[model samples]
Target: MRGPHNIIRLIRTGATLERTGAMKVILDAYEAPRLLRMVVRGVVWPFQWLGMKGDTSMPPATRALTALGPAYIKFGQVLSTRPDVVGDELAVQLRVLQDKLPPFPIDVAKDSVRDALDVQVRDVFDEFSEPVAAASIAQVHKARLKETGEEVAVKVLRPGIEKAFQRDVDAFYFAADVIEFLSPASRRLRPRDVIAHFEGVVKGELDLRLESASASEFAANTVGDEGFRLPDVKWAYSGRRVMTMGWAEGVPLGDNDALDAAGHDRTRLGERVLQLFLSHALRDGFFHADMHQGNLKVAANGDIIAYDFGIMGYIDEYTRRVYAEILFGFIQRDYKRVAEVHFEAGYVPADRDVDEFARALRAVGEPIFGMDASHISMGRLLSYLFEVTERFGMETRTELILLQRTMVVVEGVARSLSPQLNIWDVAHPIVEDYIKTSIGPRAVLRDLAKTAAVMARFGPRLPGLVEAALIRQSEIEAPHNRGGHRKMWALMFLGGLVAGSGAVALAVVL
Candidate 1:
């Protein structure tokens, strides 16, 4: 399925774009060169008959992506946030891919719930309504628990979605391979690795149980966070194919009219959204990666309600520290420090000149600083950053893909709420606080404590390890000196252990 057969898939993709009248619009938005546009049209136009004939009422781009399957729909959702890249018209059209796609039949959803929970729908849900929202992987139904009489949202995986996603992912792998082979420049971005990461995330999302667990963990992590909340997971009602959580009542984040009607402060809401995302990413190292407007809402009391925990992002402590340093450097306009941090984290190749790289970074950062959100263009900034990374021999870090992408999407979401929001102003304090906690003397003590705990695990075996080292050293030395060598090695090892233990004690006391 991932072989030459995918050529057919690729052709169908292009043909769908052609037939739906999206090919030209997309090419034009991307500013494709004359020759490239001519070549693309020549290649894709002839096979337009092979394309899927999607709903005629939908916009061209939306219809094409919806007809293609879940993967393309997800792609469209991401593009929806990048109006600067896709153009405002197409971005508006693609917003439907977020949570308003046509849903499966209610009967089918009920059958799925029954099969997953091994109980009749009527027995478990006292009032199960039709799908209130549908997206790429799953749809949500407004329901009431029979036992507790509590309202909940029951999410059921689309029928045959696994096979649908796998098919599209296979085609994506083939396309990535072709891109890498045909264009040497694209290799630095690791197209295939990006697809592999997408595949892993989709697979995790397909299992409702994983989403339920993710929601639970995110809830626990954010319990202390103010003005942010997640719906409680209904564990007993959740399964691989079906998930249930407490119903969230709020106005969608995208509905500015409704938010205003409800007296929610859009500017403050925007700032809070950005701050919450940063806090989760830097402090907890785990965040809701898919934080588009569709997954967010504002309650009557102004608390932001987040639901649909399918795709999440996670960075380790070290990576989080590096990220914080880079951001803090930018906030302070310390381009050299930002460049140094990139090198220290091995994100840029060692051969790259730090001073020159710092200059390149300055080119990227300086333009955006002191500029209002309305003046700055994140899309252009990201494009320039991409070129800089490519020039410096920085390969795509797969672990940070979700984090980076979510940052872009979240920024878009925040801006939608408050068009004049200053992203840098909102982000500075969070990054600064993270840096203070994660990069100083206290951080060193924390690291030392962790190291000591790990070393303590080997404490019982130290004597045996020392004996083995001494014996090996004595064997390597002259036979006559074995006794003296053993004594000397023992003292050195014992002294080192004492010093290490003393340091650990001092750290603990401090």
Candidate 2:
């Protein structure tokens, strides 16, 4: 089923693009190579009749992607933030896919709610209005709780969305296989691993219960963060296919006119958005991965309210330190330190020359430093950074994909609010502060404290463990060797203890 169906799906995907007249438009926007464009056109053109004829009213690219399914729409949403990659005109057209997709019927949504919660809409809500917002995976209905009489947003999964996403993802897996098999150079990017990561994220999104938990955790993490908040998740009303949260009332962050009408300071809002994202990423190690305009809103008091917690990004403490240091290095224009950090983190191959990599990194960081806020493009910088890393034989770090993508999207959102927003200026204090806290003497003491706690827990059992180890070693040796083995083991244990103490002392000195 996968082989035949995936081939058909791939052909139909191309055919749909061709039939909707988007094939050329997309290629031109991406500036695809002449030979590659010709090859793509040749491949998809012949199967035009097999494709779905998307709505003729919308733009070609939008229509084709909408007709494709959820996965394609999600891809379009990501591209909408990258006007530098897809071009402004096409990016504008694709932004409509963010939260403007046609929603499923109210009856279907009600049935889904009922199925998920084992209760009728009337049983839980005093009034469940028609969907107020809709996107690829889910739709939200404005509802009032019957018991509390409080307004809440009820999010319901689109009917059959799981199967649709699974189908498209299967096709994507097949396409990745084909690409890797035909083009060995593409293997470094690990196309299959990319799809697998996408699949894992999407699967988590498909279950509303996970989204509920994510929202809860995010709310807890962001507590007391100034001018930023997440809607409170209504746990009792949440289920696998349905989630409810306190309604967020505000103007959409994308509507500049509305924001201006509300008298919000656009420049301050922009800086706050960027600063908040950095704070969350560096300090909390968890953030709203989808920070695009559609998922963000501006309250009247200028608080940046984020919802749609289906996708969140998390890195461990060590990765967070690495990320903070990289940002700090770039801000200081110390390309050599940046290159060293990459190698230290094993991001670049050990065999690569550190000096040469530093030179390449300088080529990337230097050009963007002196540019005006409006002139600098984070998206372009990231694209160039990718090229440099690839040349240096750095493999794609799957864990960082969400963080990087969210950064680009958050930058776009901030720029929309303030065209002259200086990203580096806003990010500097946050990154520098994080470095001072996480990597300095305080951090060393914290690590030592944690280590001491672990050692303390195991302290009581040390003698018995050492005795058991000696007995086991003596059993493995001969009777004649017992005395010599015990003396050697005692010396080795003492040496280890001395080494451990010396290492701790060295850590303190450093």
Candidate 3:
């Protein structure tokens, strides 16, 4: 039999606490019982005292976050967006938790590629060089195409990373459970659900096929955009553990001198990037979800070639319309309309006063809208929105928060390259276009056609539906269909027996 999950959770929390020492400090130095504080102090005080001798330049908080490993670092990235969670200053500090690791051995990388594709290394490529970039999940290397005499990049997964992540995730869930059980107030954040979401996304990232699919989908979505593009996947050399794609040619966006020297138009490039991202989000309802500078490249033809599509986002047409309305409302200074839209979307509680929420949103919008691009701050808007949401018992939407985080990062890059770039200016046209296209007469006709097709497909089921309704009406109105009741009861009994037997068989096989 499986052991109690709660027991595993306690061990994970204790281990995390011992390694990080934040919990000990929180309990001992901040609040709680004297006895418990003393116990924690006695346990963690030695580590604080004797762990480092000299020249430990990194701050205690930094060291603690690092000690927690990739899971914590990723958490730090998420927390950096939540000014409500860790406060602004702490969030800023946590944003620097870089995800860098030494490259795995070349032999290991080759072995992984061979095993995943069931082919020899020499047969796969003309030449493969050492790693050019290394990250938590995988590393990339420059390679030559065998048939076309072209250059490409080979991305290989880190060996045995899934096991390591699974172990840490097990520890994370355990801690989240104990926190929720011990503190009734902690459940509001849904810590366990947050951990589960992180697990799903990260585990998905470990699969190269999923990432390739994301890249292909994004490329298809934005193919019409003049200056936007995604790397073309090399299907012949891609699988679950390996990805090969066209090697983009451009200096990193971080290098100002190279960008200037290449005669690149920084302002135009910035505008195109902002517009492209908004189009992907608003027009298509599918986006890159991660658009940091490292994942973007400026082509010689001025196309922004996006890479590393491990994370993608999707929303239905209704949600996209609501999102566009929110943006358009904000642009028009129609806070009341914005509040009404949120209520209509079931984002805020129905009982909450729309006028009051609008006033709060106004407090966030008016000051920022008046400022220039350099002075405006999305982070402040987020803070106000979170505070407003908390008052109405609004829970977090993981996808929304991730979208916000990416927007902040993308806007930062735009401003760095072109300081006068206004995100609102770039987004307004795209949002307006989406609103016009989706809410006009054409959309109505299209939706009507779709409904007609669905009705035709279900036309045969109408008789069954009518007969079932009549039988229900007869039973309810008369209350004496003994023959029908007997037959129904007998059929239900047989169905239960069959279901139970199948379940038992499945259990045995598993």
Candidate 4:
């Protein structure tokens, strides 16, 4: 009953499993010997044609995925984030899958809005034109708010995207579950869990409401900050299927000519954008995770307006502190502190010697510090840090990965605008200010005052705490407890009995 494509995909999957050393386990877990045979037959020739003679060549995986279509492209993109699962070299290659889809048809865009919004084109917007840019899930249009005569950008969901994405996601879940069952190394990476997380992220991306909320929250976070802003959401026109935002009139940050014609200073704008993002990350603990040139615009006054808030990043107070400390340590060439912070945050394995790890970190840092400002790249620096962390068995953090990806894109855009832009110089002052306000005596006083007020409110509970402790001591001393030793012995005996029974059961049943 299998189609040619399905048969080919089966072969591709087996080839992947074989190369990754999961072939037998995959066969055992999936219980699909017949399919495995078919897979090997279907994939062998295409792979040979592609010059991937051995099981180890990931170009086979890449070619096979591309052959399988959109679903595989999405899978490749997901795998790109999981350097731990796919290995660094393969992950790097898979990064090509990001936003590689051709744009959908223009008619489909118009019909999608009409069907979703239940209105004709003229009724909704004064002028709804063609798609400006097309991406994986949707394409954007330039339009105007009908009543207000205000220009707006309308994002229309690709029709049947949910169904298409759902099919691929279901397939991904199948693959993840099978991989986790078959490979212990993959289980440590939690393949199923990673797929689930990807599912949630992509699902959230599909829901226009969540994206709007992300925009609203980010807008609020940057309200007081200067030189950077987000497009105001036109809530009345926004929904699950569509997002309408204030029409921004500005040149794309990557277009040097347009930026110059608009009277914007590329160097200054680039510096502001870099500082703004770092400030949001280090100081506010939240930031827009998708800041590529297409999603960003520069107004005549040089304010950078960030759009496409479907993806964002957040770190808690503790993560914030650790992240800042790591940056501060790297800046000062204090690899010891950086290593200690990794240990303290439980990022590096405790058994690893801190001095050894610090030495590894020094290798990543020393080169950056030695390089001229123009020669240094925050992207490359982060990439090296990831490489070092991987040596220590640190799995990628999604938020941090997203932050790094966004940084790479933003930095690239910035450099394109002004080739001489110095990211380190642009970021240093913001990082310094954030460190001062966050960890200094002034912050300590503010936190202590807040803590004192909470303690004053809980003052009456001190007597209750004493009474509870006295009652616990009385109960512990009671005779039936066997001095609290009987409970421990009983639990240990019960656990042993259960283990013994499990062993007997496994032996007898198998």
Candidate 5:
């Protein structure tokens, strides 16, 4: 429950957003009853007279969220990936939620870095400079290390941004509550869960150390991976509020003229973009979730350098296998198995007819089959697949949704590099290779070796398990036992039975 002080802050935040035309933006995007919109409008009506002139309508949904603040900007970003909840048009609009915040004062940033890392910025860094870029969450400054003189990028958290986020997220939570109350049917969309996920994302991103750790983890995951690389994290200078990383220098993927002027191979880079993204998602369980053009760069050597590790996504091995099978089924043009995988994975409800789902999936995959590399559009195929998912009543999978949206953005970025590049052509080979290597006959032997290694480690514990069982048996015979020998014997017998059964089961699984 919110205290009075927090409630007051919520009201003020709501009024400010309303005054800024954010309320109207939501009202327009979300089609609720006219009466509801009007009623809500009536509540904020008094604010228009409070020294604010006419022409109060703000920018579109994307720009409005940007205007609202950092937290709302993140909300817009999340909604961009959630086409099922926000509808296609609004989700498309929300993709423009880029960070264009004005930089904080250099003194403030210096103080923040000093306080966060518990040292003078000058002591650790030489020629520390003003921020080159400012986002809603943080800003980055270019600097060189005092010890090694290695150029590094220093990112400092926005001062008091956490409190601002808390207040705004409180308002978001309140709105979510009202949404569920007013429209019970929307509960299936999991509005509260979505907000909770949004809240978690923003909160997690606030801690710079998490981002640094993600960068290191991602770097480790893609050590030998081709065409994709992560900037090295400077652990000594990074902390909860301040992060330092190896300076990344490359033409951003968005810079068409620069890319063309660099004389890079467009066809290869585009295919690499698609292939790298798929490999990241399917091969490495982790992916750089925010892979927009701004966060990616094309190095001089033609490798892709990714920045902004704050928003990473992970797909566990089980989901990876299911995903691979689904892709394999689609690649093979076996829509029935694709549908069956969904049912087998319980993604589609059992009551749903498998044949109907197959036909639906066919509708998504068939059109792109015979198209040449230049003609096929991966984005359109994914859009169709999303449509099929909605029609089949599949609930949202957050990880997969992020993957889907990232793929769209990546494919878009790839298209910018090579207008005629076929994404599926690049994706198909990568997915096929992964399926063959990780999910085919080779995987069986790999699993057996892994199982053998696991058993080798656990074999030492078997004696300990038998010793513990014997201890229990001895306890059963103790004359002064609390439970009495009869009860103890039953427990001992049951424990022994379970242990023996488990050993047999482990043997069979191995």
Candidate 6:
């Protein structure tokens, strides 16, 4: 899959990292190939010795990644959460990579807004001020909309950051390709697919309109949800480069002094934060992945207002139901149910022993009993669970990793507010309620109704579907007897069987 140009580019990028001193990040023993890594370090050793290249002031691991640009900055953010791979010290330093960057010139910000909305600076905002915050991709400015005189925050992407990000993403793909080509050990991690996912997550942020839609969708999903809110996105003013949203006024979640002065109860607030995250993930199947203290604020009314929707996560309905049951099972101390959920989801291999998996889960769940928010370390639990998963041949679950990372960060945020907060007490009611609504008798009837609706629409087309398949099969067999026709006929037969079964089931149920 890789060509010579890719190999040349990788060497050049490696040189860039070496010069930046970011290459010094010590990796885990399992991260191969040792010869290649050693060759890189050896190649860069002279540069370090002569002090002729690279800035060594920062940690060796973070310096090079910081030099790479936004995509790699995101990689640093992820690495910060994976202490087992990068080591604790390096992970701590990598925290700075979480959207910490200098703001681009204010003139550039104005130009971006003007171009995106096709309006003059004064035409839209009555009072555009300096950027209050800046990150790897964009900077935020507080302004008053000219039409309504309403305060809103405007986010503008940096002028040339897009090109830099694209180049870095190409570099990532090149690296992934080389790894897959050279190292069999890395295939388990699925490096290329992982980079492809990273590509999506990073590039998605470039379009502010998409972010607005996501925020709107998230808000809709959390409608009637207590203690949390999302700012209304002003589509009229929002565009690819710029987004306008109602200004959220609140104390940062991490600001204890301000939180106390504002007459907010940290203990209760902490419980609300954790509850909101869990409910969004399991009940709604969507959530704000970047829940750092900076993105979360406690409003004067004690409502939590979330901002910065560029980075979001989602799961399907099936996964959502499974996640809910797993949490509920943990609450009920039913380890078998937790294990069953994993097996049913195919996260664990079917060949694995369910009882052994249950026992392993029990070991993880039992230790956290009676633990408060501070005492219950979700990260440690996940780490132990990961260890157990490896024994059972569980593959790397990329989607769930984002959820796990966010949960760990959120629990830390919650614990900071209420050291003695009983997470189990807060989570139990929510999980139990969701499971009840989504499982058992109510769930079966709901599923049947959905199935009937699907059949109602699809049943009429069954004959045509089969007929088309048969025609395709005949054409294929007449031309090329390459045995490809079997699939076409097999698909046709399956379609007919499904159509018949669905009609029969619907009639019997009615």
Tell me each candidate's TM-score. 0.84, 0.85, 0.84, 0.77, 0.86, 0.86
Q: Cα miss at 81, model 1 (Å)? A: 9.7
Show the colliding residue pairs in model 6: 22-64
Tens-place lDDT digits, model 4, residues 426-449: 877876777787778776665655
- Writing each residue's lDDT as its tens digit, candidate 3 over 102-207 gives 7999889889889988998888789989999987788998989778878898899988887767766777777677556665565666778768777878878889
True lDDT of residue 423, candidate 2: 87
TM-score, candidate number 5: 0.86
- The Cα local distance difference test for each model comes to 0.82, 0.83, 0.72, 0.72, 0.79, 0.78
The top-ranked prediction according to TM-score is 6
Report the Cα lDDT for residue 331, model 4.
75
Over the stretch 1-510, how does candidate 5's per-residue lDDT look in tens digits?
A: 565655454455456557666666565666666667776667656654442221234345654566556887778888888876777777887787667788999999999989988899889888788889999899999999999989999999999999888877877777777767876666777888888888889878998888888899999989998877877998888899999999999998888788889987877877887788788888988988888889988899999899999888899987999888888888789999999999999988899999999998998888787777776765666677767877788877878878778878888888887887766667888888888888888887677666556656766676577567667667656767655666656766765665565565467565
Candidate 2, residue 281: the lDDT equals 87
Using lDDT, give the best candidate's number.
2
Model 1 residue 20 distance off true place after TM-score fit, in angstroms = 3.5
Q: RMSD of model 5, in Å?
A: 5.0
Question: Residue 416 lDDT in model 3?
Answer: 84
lDDT of 2 by residue, 427-465 (tens): 889999999999998997887767666555765666666
Which consecutive 10 residues in model 6 have the weakest lDDT in total? 46-55
Quote the positional error of residue 280 for candidate 6 in Å: 0.6
Report the C-alpha displacement of residue 112, candidate 2, in angstroms.
Answer: 1.6
- Of 2 and 3, the candidate ahead on lDDT is 2
